[model samples]
Target: MNDNSEIQDVELAVSRWLRIGVIISAAVIVIGLILLFIHGGSGYPDDYYPHSLSEIYSGTITLKPYAVITTGLILLILTPVLRVAISIWVFVREGDKLYVIITSIVLAILIISFILGKA
Candidate 1:
């Protein structure tokens, strides 16, 4: 169709992806909370806290409530990262070097923040 229509479609797709990410994240969080209440937490703080992404994934696979919660939190945190990545792609496709650079910087900062926070 027209350029405007194509642009709107891309925007709509991006929005839809964001909405899906949030909804899935929220659902996971709710399920985790429900499991926590039902099972009384994956044996409390004295037992364990997932130390890494892999651990959380493993825990989630094992149906550990805390892991499920952490999985949800991680998903929520990564949603914006995903969005930024998508935006960068869109900017590149539109040949907007300025925005691509800006979005890349933002993404870099996000990664740095996470790294620094862990350290």
Candidate 2:
């Protein structure tokens, strides 16, 4: 009904969305970790290309599980990084110090996870 109330509503909505994002990101990282473990922790296999560029040229590319898992892990890492970057952009545009702080923390956590995943 009032300006302050509208701002509170918007803030509440943003907070809820951020919480959901964090949960989803955590889930993705967990899933990626599981896949990495299940697939022997190797990033990718070179054998998926059928041993030559000519094979790919011939439209014969075998999809290796290792390669797929590695790609999935990379995607999982990149998704949260992109989300944090977007959040940072929005915070900057809106001049919201709290959101900037929160997003920065999230970004740091994602970076840590990526590093650990690599290890």
Candidate 3:
């Protein structure tokens, strides 16, 4: 195959992935809204601290169903959006793919940490 064909295939693949990501993102946003409504809204007061790290590590933290679900939904929506932006920036400038990959990984880890911490 010619270089042009290869490039076209890559572009098509990327487009397909982007479309899937968008659909998933929309679904996550809907779920997040549903959770926000079910959980009594997004803005929690300072006194609403639900868990201590020690208790969480000890597996004693009382996990609130709504909070965990809402947090996961929010992360699901945000992570892909962030990844796409970073990926586009990197791809456009022909920057290092490693940077994009590392950024995505770090964001994922942070999201997981936040979810676990809140739970």
Candidate 4:
């Protein structure tokens, strides 16, 4: 197809995925909040919460409202990262090396920030 059409298609696909991700994240958070209200608490001590992926995963598996909320937050954080990674792929596929490089750097920095934030 024409370049403009192709670009529109890519944009639509990316936009759709981003929308889906955000909707799912918001739904999860809402569910978690409902559970929290039903249980009358976050299921964690006032000063304690899931601080790691594993902890969040375990807590979610156990149906902990706080963990579910944290999982939703993580999903929200990851949605943009997913979009950037997709942009890198689209750039590579279109033979746009400069954007590929720039997008890759952005992804790398995002990952580094996450790691450092955890540290």
Model 1 — which ten-residue stretch has the worst lDDT?
Answer: 40-49
Q: How many backbone clashes does every candidate have?
A: 0, 0, 0, 0
Candidate 1 regions with alpha-carbon error over 4 angstroms: 43-47
Ranking by lDDT: 4, 1, 2, 3
lDDT of 2 by residue, 2-118 (tens): 867856766676666666666665665565566657666434454342323343223312333344434444454465466577678767767999999998988888888866774
Off by over 4 Å in 2: 1-65
Model 1: per-residue lDDT, tens digit, 53-115?
A: 788888898878899988988898999899999999999999999999999999999999998
- TM-scores, one per candidate: 0.88, 0.42, 0.39, 0.96
lDDT of 2 at 113: 83
Positional deviation of residue 84's Cα in model 4 after best superposition, in angstroms: 0.1
Q: Better model by TM-score, 3 or 4? A: 4
* Poorly placed runs, candidate 3 (over 4 Å): 43-119
TM-score of predicted structure 3? 0.39
User: Scored by CA lDDT, what does every candidate get?
Assistant: 0.89, 0.58, 0.56, 0.93
The C-alpha RMSD in Å for every predicted model, in order, reads 1.9, 8.7, 8.1, 1.1
